[model samples]
Target: MATIKDVAQRAQVSTASVSRVLSGDARTSAEMRERVLTAARELRFRPNAVARSLRSTGTRTIGLVVSDLLNPFFTELTRAVEDAARAAGYAVIVGNADESPEQQDHYVRILLGRQVDGLIVVPTVETSPLLHEAAASDHNIVLVDRRAVGVDAPIALADGATAIDELVDHLVATGRRRPAILAGPDLAGSSRERLAAFRAAVARCGLDLPESRVIHGDFRAGSGHDALAALLTGDDAPDAVFVANGPMALGALQHLAEAGGRAPRVPEDLALAVFDDMPWFSLLRPTLTAIQQPTAALGERALSMLLARIRGEDVPDERLECRLVLRESTEPRSAR
Candidate 1:
């Protein structure tokens, strides 16, 4: 119920001064800002965001529509974005798309409807019409961790080439001759990049990556489970596998833990590694060998790009490097 005028009176400052201080205007003196803030806090004064946004174009808030929150990669990325945005005096509204194009489009509509100053989208695929429309309309957007085809926006993503190559080298040196990959949906940008890097890595080590070894998953546990089940058969079954993401790695491990069925003991019968390192990975009996994406960098970089675009600055896509972390899961076949 407290008004700006009430706080202004308490601080003995004009309403205009209070407005400037509350809006984070740099022109406000430190002493005046402190006085106004103290009075406002004492009075429990809350700014009318709707009225303020009506007067100014920027809401001082942006939206982040991510591919899926179930994946810890996105969860960590979200926290990073929140931290950077908060430090820059902005707030974030996060939308979880759950890897559904329709859901992503719906969230886009809702986020734009809220008049968000800008948006950072982890696109579901390259064919999202709304993404194109938003770019064409000049709505501020920055793609993170993935790209939407033909969306003329700056992007911040990961380049897993070097890490994948390193992973392959490690596997080969450890005697994992026959290695395979459990990839995500083929159309997804990250999936395509990772698959390419993985194949190129295999080839570099004089190994063959048959199309049959490239099993596709939906970046979820169930799909990962099914993909592993499909690959674990016949004389040609792979001796090693690299799961593309954390959830899929979990599912693949689950398949190996089936209660009554014969399961291949890891590093004994099979070797395992994964992309997208998670905190809990180390807790597993045999810690997982995983690739760690520059998750925090991705969030901070994407948000900075989005903020720059909002400020009428031109930005370009940049890719961060990934790291291969060694753990017990991919130990040498001889040691096992």
Candidate 2:
């Protein structure tokens, strides 16, 4: 309940002097600044963020929206983003889109209404009129993970090309001719990019991937489960499957379990690999091969790029690389 007046009295200075000190005004004397800060610390005083934002150039806060909070990849990205934002003297507010465009739009409005200095989003849809308006109005927006089709903003995303190459090479080398893919929403930039890379890599290895084997999901476990189930029950069952993200991978694993009990023994019956890596992946029954994305780097870079945009700096789109991590799930055919 301590106020600016209380701090001013405790510091033996006028309210104006206290305000100047708290605002980081260069005109304040060192002795006066010290006294004001000391008084604030002693009183446990917290500034009114709204009032401070009104008086300053920024709110010192940023808003981040992720497609799905259930995904460990996004959770780690959120943690890294918060860490980087805090290090840069900013606070972060997060919103989970849950792969719904309407939900994403709602959170975008809420964040904008809260007067966040900037926004970073993993857009759920291909295009959004609201996002375009915000960007056009100089709202300091940055796209992370996936780029909205019509939103003209700087973006930070993963480059899955090399990882896909490595995955295809491994599968082909292991004598797996028929490979399947569980892709996320086809409209999402990240999903599209990953699918494209997968196709290209398969072609590079001179492997054929039928259209029926390319399944799309909503980046959720249930969708993954359904997609994998369809593939498993099909007449032309694939020898290997690559899931797009972690939650979906978990779903695929679950489907594998429920579909035929212990019939599928990973590399023996159906090899599996996923796009995103997690600590627990190594502990799974057969262990999982995955593409390790630089999640921390992606978060840090997104914040940095957002900050730059907020400061009126031109920032180009950034794409970080992902590396393939081989594991028990992708054992060679001979070993299987």
Candidate 3:
């Protein structure tokens, strides 16, 4: 309930002087500003955000829209974005689309309605129209993780093709001829790119990947487990599997443990490689081999791009590289 007037009275200064001090007006005397700040802190005074936003035309808030909150990839990205935004003196509002176009559009409207200073989105393919509308409206919008088809917005993305190529090359070099892939939903922008790269790599290696060896699943642990079960139970089980994300990799591992089936034992029966370098991956039973995306850097760079756009600066689409991390799960065939 403490107000600016209370702080001004406690500091023995006028309300105008307190306002100047709080706003960081350079014209205010340093000694007076310190006194007002000390009084405000002692009184537990909080500024009226609504009034301040109305006056300054800035809410100091950035909206972040992600496809899935449960995925560790997005969770880590969110943490990084929140931390970077806080350091830059902005608050973040996160919205999960659940990979649904309707939900994505709903959150977009809500964020705009709330008058957030800017938006960063991992867009669904169906929401491209909505994104285009927002972009045409002159709203500050930046794409993160996924780029839209027809919309031209500042973007931050991983090099999906190169990452997948590296994984394939490693598998081939390790003496794994029959390789399977568990890919995320093809509608997702990043997923589609990964699938394309995977196919191209297989072709270049003079390997033919039949439709039976590829399974499509949502980027969830359960989906991964189910996909692996389906593949292993079928007639043609692969000598190696490349899972696109961390959760899927874990799920596949879980299924392998429970099935008690023979062949493709860790590094011997079947080698495993996946995307995303999760914190605990290195400590797992076989210590997973992974293609590590710079997730923290991706989140930080997305925030920086958004902030720059909010400041009226022009930014272009960007792609960050992925590093391959070798571990016991993908030991050379001879060593196994």
Candidate 2 wrongly placed segments (more than 4 Å): 1-56, 260-262
| Model 1, global lDDT | 0.88
TM-score of 2: 0.82
Against the reference, the lDDT scores of all candidates come to 0.88, 0.87, 0.83
Which stretch of 10 consecutive residues in model 1 shows the poorest summed lDDT?
12-21
lDDT of 1 at 89: 91
Candidate 1 per-residue lDDT over residues 188-297, each given as its tens digit: 99999899999999998899988778899999999999999999875569989999999999999898888325878778778899999999999997889999999999
lDDT of 2: 0.87
> What TM-scores do the predictions have?
0.83, 0.82, 0.81
Q: Which portions of model 1 show Cα errors greater than 4 Å?
A: 1-55, 259-261
**lDDT of candidate 3 vs native?**
0.83
RMSD of 3: 11.5
Which candidate would rank higher by lDDT, 1 or 3? 1
Whose lDDT is higher: candidate 1's or candidate 2's?
1
